[model samples]
Target: MPALSPLCLACAAALSVPGAAWAQAAPVTLKEVVVSGSRSERALDEVPASVDVLTGEDLDGAQVQDIRDLARELPNVSVKRAAQRFSGVSPGGTGRDGNAGFNVRGLEGNRVLLTVDGIRVPRELTSGVFGSASFGRDYYDLGLISRVEILRGASSALYGSDGLAGMVAMSTTEPAELLKAGQTFGGRVGLKLDSENDSRGVGLTLAGRPSDTLQWLGSVQVGRSSELDNQGTNTALNSTRTAPNPQKDEDVSVLGKLVFTPGGGQKHTITLEHVDKSSEVEAYTGRTTSATSGSVLDLDGTTDMRRSRLSWDGRFRIDSAWADELRATVGVQDSDSREVTHEQRTVSPTQRSRDVTYSEQLWQGVLQAEKTRALGGDWSQKLVYGADVTVSHMDNLVTGTGAPSYERYPLKRFPETRETTTALFVQSEFATDRWSVIPALRYDRFELKPRNDGLYPLDAASLSDSAFSPKLGVIFRPASNWSLFGNLAAGFRAPSPLQLNNYFENPFGNYRTIPNPDLKPETSQTLELGTRGSTHGFQWEAAVFNGRYKDFIEELVAVGGSMFTPADPLTYQAVNRGRVRLHGFELKGHYALGKATNLRVAFGQTQGKDTVTDRPLNSVNPAKLVVGLDHRLGDWKLGAALTHVAKKSTSDIDTSGTPNQFATPAYTTLDLSASWQVTPSTRLSAALRNVTDRKYWEWTNVRGIAAHSPVLDAYTAPGRSLALALVTEF
Candidate 1:
C-alpha cells in the first residue's frame, strides 16, 4: 500500500480549522422526497424514523465499489469477511457467501432486507432458521447504481416481515440533466489496476434523453480479477496459503431504464436489469492430521449465477376531496445459481466431486396513496394507505458420487417450495410550528407450502401454514435542529420449504436429515429510541434498541443409526426453541473542522443471549469503530480512514466441555485515496486498502479436518491491495 501524498496531507490540516465547522448546520427549509419506506413522497423532516441518503456524488467521492465497501461509511453498520474455505457458501458471485454478512445494530440475516426498485431478493438458507443469508454485502456491479438509501431500525411497519432488522434501497441511474436538455449524451468509461492482487478491470455507463417526455439510461460493466495471494509466512494468518494462488473471479452486468412523463404531470419509470457472474477458486482447508502424514485438503469449486429484474413505477396526482397523490409499483425477479465442487489432497493422490443447484422466481405488486391537508392553524396532516403482495418459488438439488458405496442412492433429485405474502398498512403525520408527530401501523399475512415429489416416500412431506404480524411507531420534533423517534414493531418469519419437505434417509449411516412439517414460525418484537441533531459545526445521531424473540426455530444436531443396523450417524433437523434477547447501541457523527476538511466517526456494539441455557448466541458481532478525514481543494480531493474490529470467538464447539474456540484478534487498517480532476469533464482516482499489510483472520468457520490439527486452517480475507481508475462524462 502507498502513503498519502504530502499535498493531500496539507489540505487535510487546513480543513480542520474552526471556521469550517459552520458548514455543518442543517438547512432551515425542507424538501419533498420519495423514500422507499413510505407509501408516497413527503418532506424528509416528516418521516417517522432515522433515514440516511447517499447520493451518487458521495459514492464517487468515496470510491465505493460495492455495498460491502459502502457499509464502512455508514453509522452502526459493520461488514465482516468469513473464514477462507467458506467462500463458496454463498450461491452467487456477489460475494455474500459464508465470509460476507452485514450486521446493523448487531442483527443480521433476514432482519436486514435489501431491495432494488422495490423488488425483494431471496434470503440464503443456513442451519439456523434465522435469516442469516445476506445478499446485500456481496458484489453487484455498481456502474449502474445512482444512489443508495438506508432506513435504520425495525421497519416491519412499512416493509413487513424481513424488516425486523432494517432496509436498504438501491436506486439505479437515470438520464442526467445535461442529457435531458439535449446538450449531449453523458457517459463514463474507466479502468482499474490493482497492485497486490495483480488484477485489472474496466467498465462503461451511458445516459441520454430521446425526447422532452422520455429519457433512457444504460450501463454495462465487466471485470476479471487475478488470483489473490496472502502476505504472511504463517499459513494460519495468511489471507491465502499455498504460494497465494487460488482465489479468482469474473463478473458482467447490464442495466437499462426508461422514464416517461406527459408534459408536466407526474413521472413514470420502468427498469430492466440483468447480471451474470462466474468464478473458480481453490481455498485452504484448515490443517488436518492423518495416521500417515499431516496435510491440508484443497477445496476447489466453480460457481455461476444469473439474475434479471423488471419493474414499473408511476407517480400521479389525483384531484379528490381527500386524496392528493397516488403511487404504484409492480416488479418481478428471477435468479439461478449452480455450483460444482472437486476436493483433493494437497500432498496425496485422490479426488472427490459434488454438485448443487438453486433456482428462484419472485413476483410483486404494490399500490399506495397519500393525502395532505390543513388540520388547523400552524398544523398540517398527511395520511398514507398502501397494499402489497409477493409470491416466490424455489427449487434446490444436490448430488454427488462421493457418498460411501453402501449409501449410493439416486444420483440426483429436486425439492420444490413456494411462499406468498400480502400486506396492508397506514400512517399519519401531523405537524405544528415547532413540533411534528407521526404514527404508523401495518398488518401482514404470509403463507408457505411445500410438497414432496416422492423422492423420499417415507418422509411425509406436505404442509401449509400462515401468520400475521403488526407494527407501530412514532416520531417527534421538538426543535428545528432536534428530532426524537421511537418504535415498537413485531416481525414474523414462516418456515421454509427445506424445513418442511426435504428429507434424506441413509441406511448405510453417514449423515441424514428429516424435514419437520410441524415447524412453527419465528416471531420477534423490538423497541428503539433515537435522536438526531446538529450543533455549531457538528451533526450527530445516537440510538439504543432491544428485541425479544419467541418460538425461534433452530437446527438441532441428533445422533442416530439405521433402523436395521447399528452405526453412528449425524443428523440435523429444525426444532422450536425458547426465547432470545438482543440489546445494542450506535453512535455516529461528522464534524466540519475548517474550509477544506471534515472528520467522521461511527461506533456500534451488540450483545445477544439465549434465555433457556443462559449462553451467548452464535455469530453475535463484537464491537467496532471507524474514523475518517476528508479534504477537497480546487481540482483535488483526498481522504483517509481507519477501521478497528474488536476480538471475537468463533461459533464452532465440540462436546469435550472445552469449546473449539478461535480468537479473531482485533486489527486496525488504514486506507487512503485521492482524485485529481484532469479536466472539467474527466477525472482520475486511485485508492489503497490495508495500507499496513497486516495479516488477520476475518471470521471463524467449521473445518472438515481433525480438530486441533494444523491442516485445518481456512483462507483469510484479502490482504493489501491498490486500485486506480479514470472517469469521463460529456
Candidate 2:
C-alpha cells in the first residue's frame, strides 16, 4: 500500500499551512449542506464520509419511487429487484442488468458508483448467461430529484472504478435553490397515486429569475403502470398464475436548468436531461409439463430504457491569490438497454424469440481547485484539487428465432468496447478549535479496447490499469454537543470488458466462455469508527465498520462435468478470489418529543466471509431495525414506521454454490404517513406500505434457481402498498 505521489500531494497541501493560533472557533451549524461527499460544499458534519441525504422533503416523505426505497431508511443499503427472465434462466441481478445497482456497504451489483449532475453513470457489462448487469439505470425520475447523495464507505479515493462500494449522487432542481429575493416566476404541480402498482403519476415544476444575471429550472415527469400483485403466498410467480399476469410500465421524464451570475458572484451552469422507460411482463410458465418434454412453457419479458445527459458548469471566484473555488465540468452521457424475449409452448408446441441490445456512450471532464488559508493562531486550511476524465463506448447485440430456436445469430453479445477513465484528486482539511484532520488522495487510470469485427472467438485485446487510493480522517469535538470519528480507506475495482474478454456460444451447450487476460482488480480496505451527538432535543449517530477484500472476481466453471447445465454446456472462468471479510454495525437516532414531537431510530448489522471457501459473502444484510414516529398538527403531519428483518443463513446461495438456497424468513413491516396543508398553495400526501400484509423475501433478493425449480426464490417483496400525493404551488 504505497503509492501517493504528486509531490506527496503537494507536500501534503503544504503541511496544512500551520496550526498555532487561538480564538475564532465558532462554526458547526448543519441541518444540511452536502455535496456528494466532498466534491465541494460541506457542512453536514463537515463531511468525513458516511453520508445519506434525501431532501425535497425527504422525497416527499418517503414516497420515493425506487432505489429500493432506501432499504427502509439506510444502513448498509440495498436495491436489487429484477426478476422474470428465463431461457436457461438467471437475470436475477435485477432487471436490465445495470449490473447490480446500489448495494453499498454490502457491496452493490457493480460496486456502487452512480451519479447524475456530477456525471458518471454508465456501466452494464454482460455476455449473457441469461442476464446480469447492474449499476443503476434505475430509470431516474424520483420526481426529478432535488437531492440524493448517499456515500457509505470505500469511495475509491474520490470516485474511480465503480467506487469500490460507495457513491450514489443524484441532483436536479435548482433555480435559486429555494429562492428568496422577491422570487420571480415559479410553478409546480403534481399528482400521484399507487395502490400496489396500479400506478399513475404526473409532475412538473419550473423556476425562473429572468434577470439579475439569469436563473432557470424545469422538470416534467409522467408514469403509468399496472399489475403488481403477489402475496398469494404459495410464491413462485404467485403460485403458478394462470391469468391476470400481464404487467406493464411506462415512464417519461425531462429536466433542464440554466444559471449564471455575471457579477463578482462568478457562476455559470447549464444542464439538461431525459429519461424514457418501459417494462413488461407476461409469462406464468410455472412449468407443469416437460415429461421427456411434452411442452408447456410460456414466458414473456421486456426492459427498454433510454437516458441522456448534457452538462456544463463553471464557478470561479479567483482574482488570483492562490484560488478559492475554480471549478469546471463538461459532460455528455447516453445509455440504452433493450432486452425482449418471448417463448410459448402449449403441449408439444414451440415458438421463440430473443433480442438483446445494450449501448453506452459517455464523455466527461472536470477540473477543480479550492483553497482556504490562514494557518497561524486559530489554525485553518482547506484544499481540494481535482481532475477527472471518462470516456466510454460499449455495444452488444444479439437476435433470435425457434424449434425452440436460438442456435445463434451473429451473436456479439458485447464484443465492441472502448473504455477510458482517469482521475487525480486530493483533499485536505485541517481545522483548529474542535480539531479536524482529513487527508485524501487518488490516482486512477483504466483503459480497455476491443473492436471485435471478426465476430470474436479471440484476438482483440488491450488492457491497462492503475490505482492508488488513500484516505485518513479524524474529527473530535470534545464538547459543544460532541463528535468523534476515525477513518482509513482504500478501494478499487476494474476488470470488465465483459470480465476481461468475454466469449460465449452455445449452439446448444457445447460449452464456451473463457477469456481472462489475466484479470485482477478488486480491492478494498476500510476501517471506520464514529460517534456524533447533539444535546437536549437529541440527535445521534454511531458507527463501526471494517472491510478488507482483495483480488475478488469469482465465476469459475469448466465443463468436463460440474454441470449446472447449459443443456450440457458449462465453461466459464474469471478467477482471483482470495480474501474478503466485511463487518458492520450502525445506529442512528433522533428525538424531539417536544414542539410537535418526533422520534426515529435505525440499526444495522452485517457480516461477510470468503477467506478461501469459508463462504458467505453476498454482501450480508440481515439484522435490521427501524422505528419512527412523528406528529406536527398545526398544518397536519403524522407518521409511523417500523421495519425489522433478520434471518439469512449465509449466502452465495447458502454457502458458495449460489442458486436460490431457500430459507430466508424473518420479517416485520409497517409504515404509514400523512401530510396536508390544503391551502396556501395546496398540498396533500399519503403513504401506507406493508402494514402487516407480511410475507417477505429480501436477502438481496436472492437469486439462483434450479433445484426442484418451478419458479423458485427471491422476488416476493412488494405486498401491501398505497400511496397518494397532490401538490400545487405558485
Candidate 3:
C-alpha cells in the first residue's frame, strides 16, 4: 500500500517486465498453525513470542543440508563451524569440533535447547582442562525432518532447564504426509550434491498402509564428503599454510516409525532411529616448528560419533469434565563420541597415540493433559498441564601410549555420573473479545550423583538444586488485522556433572583443576514487547527484548594458588560471576507484489555485557540485514537473496585471551536459487551462493583467532559454491 526500500523497489521493477509468463492468481497469506509456542496447535499470529517455522518445502527449495546452512534464513541465529587445524595435545580446538551448536540471542551451547519430536538431544562434552576433547551437538539428519520451529526467548516455564535462551523443536515426517487420498503406498527419493564441501548424498523414504488401522514409514540416508573449501592459496604444510586440511567424512542415518489405531479415539506411534558419522583428518599444521630438534614428522586424527533412539507416543481423546484430551510419551536415547590422535616422532623413531571417548544414555517420559471450557458469553479459557522425568548416565575414558613420564595413561578426568530431573508445569490462557492473558509456571528438581571407580579422586562431590520458573503474557487487539503483545519470562540451567566434579592434576606442568561442589545454577529473566499485523497482502513484526542473567558459570577460572608448591599446584575451578545483561531488537516483514511475486526483509542487532566486569560479551553476533525476492511462473520458481553483515569492532571484543583479537570486516553476499518441476512427480532445485566470490570470514567461525595469525584465510567462508538436489515421488 505504501512505498518500500530501494531493494523492494528494484524487485517490483523486475516483476513488471514486459514479456513475463503469468501463472494462476493466488492470494498470499501468513497463517501457519504452530504448536511449540503453547504446546497446542494455534495460529502463528496468536503466539506472543518470536517464533519462526520452516516447512519441508522450504528446506527442499533452499537445499539446506546442515545447521550452518539453515542459519542463513533466520535472524539472530548462527551456528559455528571452524577449520580443522587441531592435532595431538590440543583436542578442544574449534576445527576438531564441527558444528559446535546453536546460538540464540547472545547465549549458546547448553543454554539453547534442541529437541526432536519432544525428545531432548544430548548436550555437548565441555570439559575445559580435565578432558581436552570437545564433542559437538549436531546429530540429526535433515532428510528425515518435516518441520522445524524456533522459539526465541526464555522458555523454561514450559520446558524446564536448558531453556535459558530459546528452544528448537523439530518434527519428523509421518506416513500421512506422504500418502494421498485412497493411496495405500507412497514415498519419495532424493539426491543431493554440494561443491562447498564436495559432498554427495542420497535419501530414500517409503510409507505404506497395509491395513485400515496400521501404517508404517521408513527412511535412510547416506553421504560422503571431503574437507570444506575456502579461499586459502598456500598449499604448503605447517601452521603458516592457509589451505584447508586433508579430511574425509562419512555419514549414515536410518529412521523407522509404526502407527497403530486400535479403536475409539486412541492413537499410538512407535519410532526408532540411528545415526553414525566418522571423519579422518591429516593435521599438517600441528607439526613441530622448523627450528625445533626431534621435530614431529606427521600427525593424524580420527573421530567417530553415533546416536540411537527408541520412542513411543500415544494420544487419547477422553471427553471428561476434568480433561478433554491426554497425551503420553516415553523415549530412550544414547550418544557416543570417540577421538583418536596419532603422532609420529623422529627422536626415537617412535609413535605416540591418544584415545578419548565420551558417552551418554538417557531415558525420559512425559504425561500431559489439556482442557478447554467457556466461562461466560464471548469469554473462554484453556488449560494445559504436564509432568516429565529424565534420567541420564554419562561416562568418559582416556588412554594413551608413549605419554610423558609424569602423566599416566588410562585416567578419568571425572568419575562416572548420573543426572536426574523431575518437573511439573501448568499453563492457562483466558481470552475475551479484545484481550488475551496467559500465565504459566514450572517447578523442577535436579540431582547429580557420581560413582568413583578408583581412578583419579577418592572423594567426589554431588550437587542438588531446585528452581521455579514463571511466565506471563498479554495481548491486545484493537482491530482484526493488528495486535500488540508483551511477555515476562524466567529461565534457568542446572550445572552439568563435569562442571561440578572435574578433577585433574598435572605434576610436570605444576597445575591442577579442582571441583567446585558449591556451584550454583544459572538463572535469567527476560522482558519482551512486540507488535505484529497483516494488511493488504503484507505481514510484519517488530520486537525488542532485555534479559538479565545471574550466577553465570565460568569454567576453569584461575584461583589463588602457587605452582611452585609441590603439595598444592595452581588450582583452577568453576566459579559463578555476578550479573549479565543482553538486549536486542528484530524487525522482519514480507510483502506480496502480485499473484506471482513477493519481497521480504529481515534485520537483527544484539548487544550484551558483563555488568560486574563491564566488558562486552563476545558471544553476541554482529548486526545483520537480509533482503530477498521470489517469483513463480507456471511450474518454475526463481529467488534471490542478499545478506549484509556489519563489522565486529575492536571495542566490542574481549581482549583478555588474545589482546589482538581478529575483528571480522563488514561483508555482503548474494545467492540465487531456482527450481523446476520437470514432471508430475519430479522436482529439481539448484542454489548458487557467493556470486561475487569475495573472500570473507564469519564472526562466529573465527572468534578466538589472533589478529596476526598467519593462516587467516583458513577461517574464511566458502568463496563460491553450488548445491543441487532432485526429488521424485512414487
* RMSD after CA superposition, every candidate: 10.5, 23.2, 9.7
Q: TM-scores of all models?
A: 0.84, 0.34, 0.94
**lDDT by residue for model 2 (1-730), tens:** 3466453455356435444442233333324488877777777776666787877767883377656675567877877765543331334323444224677777775677888888877674544453533324575878887788888888777777777768888888887764657988887888888877688888888888989898888888998986555553343443254223457888899989889889884898999898888877765532434424544366666778888898998898773555666899998988887777666555433665666677888888989887776666776777678889888888777665542333456466447788888888887777777888878778888888878566556775677878887777878888868788877777788877777766765555456676677777897878888888789998988888888888888754452543356565667766776688888878988999989989989888878777877777765777788888989998888988888888775343344454546656788989888888989777898889888888777766554443355444325666788888888777
Q: How much lDDT does candidate 2 score?
A: 0.71
Which runs in model 3 stand beyond 4 Å of their true positions? 1-32, 90-92, 130-132, 289-291
**Ordering by TM-score:** 3, 1, 2
Candidate achieving higher TM-score, 2 or 3: 3
| Per-model lDDT | 0.63, 0.71, 0.84
Pitting candidate 2 against candidate 3, the one with the higher lDDT is: 3
* Per-residue accuracy of model 1 over 632-699 as CA lDDT, tens digit each: 98899898989887776443222223355455567788888899999988888888888888766543
- Give me candidate 1's TM-score against the actual structure: 0.84
Q: State the lDDT at 608 in candidate 3.
A: 92
| Better TM-score candidate (1, 3) | 3
lDDT ranking, best first:
3, 2, 1
The candidate scoring highest on TM-score is 3
Residue 605 lDDT, candidate 1, scale 0-100? 78
